[model samples]
Target: MSPSPPLPKERRIRWGYWRSMMKIELTRQNVHNEFAKKVELISGQNLFACYQCGNCTAGCPVAFGMEVGPHQVIRYTLLGLEEEALGVNTFWLCASCLQCTSRCPKGIDIARVMDALRTVVLRKKERKDHVRIPEFPEGFLEKVPQIAFVSGFRKFLS
Candidate 1:
């Protein structure tokens, strides 16, 4: 008899999940494949190529401070876990230093992927508070050039 063909990742995960006898139900409706496709379209990077090697996370300087880290962010995006991916502080915490991107064996441009996620979240207005341009006190504002505030907001909000 021939061996069974390998299951797709989503199915394999679900199969293992059922074997574990977990009470949680897998919600197919919650996943939107278009999100992943859009990220690839905008970033021009194949994020699905990432195999969870953790190289991105290992080389990330700010990984210690990130709630989800670099690899998890990619995995979440690849799996189409939109809410879970966007809910974390990973994108906000990313320094865009490109360490993860450079070291990535797949040349996936992990930084761009994170930026794409943030852009989608911002565009959709899904999280109103994702990247707040904090209002500086009037006193501090007066001391600094107006351009400074604008530049700073442009830098961090991206």
Candidate 2:
């Protein structure tokens, strides 16, 4: 009947088309090489296991002052914006109280991530201007030896 409508033309499937689509999507999303690798490294914490329960954010003491908060920091890292993640004052201001880590549903050591970010920032020569904590506070260097001895004595007793 009417040659069965000439049998509808089959849609062409091209592997190259799929690849190009993927590339376009990634680029549109601002995803790049550095972000990919950084996400993989940070995922070692099993953060992908996180379900965004918000416990880490709720428990973080310095979350109020954070540019992106702990949860968003993890997300930024996962997205490969390592410099953006580490550049936040939150990384330096963290109290390291472990509350976020302890409360994490995925059991991620958030404190460890913070420490790792700080280490990365410290090792970068370009980040010297980003140093938040002074190596020696005013008048503190003059009493260094005395402070060291007292600290060492306290440690020995403990």
Candidate number of the best lDDT: 1
Q: What RMSD does each model have against the real structure? A: 9.6, 13.1
Model 2 deviation from the true structure expressed as Cα RMSD, one decimal place: 13.1
lDDT of 1 by residue, 44-85 (tens): 998768889999999999999999778888777766777888
- Per-residue lDDT for 17 in model 1? 71
Q: What TM-score does each of the candidates earn?
A: 0.66, 0.57
41-150 in candidate 2: lDDT tens per residue? 64356555656777988988888888877777776665667777877887677777799989987788887776666655565676435423355478865676986655
- Candidate 2's clash total is 1
Kindly give the stretch of ten consecutive residues in candidate 2 with the minimal lDDT sum: 149-158
After the best TM-score superposition of candidate 2, give how far the Cα of residue 137 lies from its true spot, in angstroms. Answer: 9.9
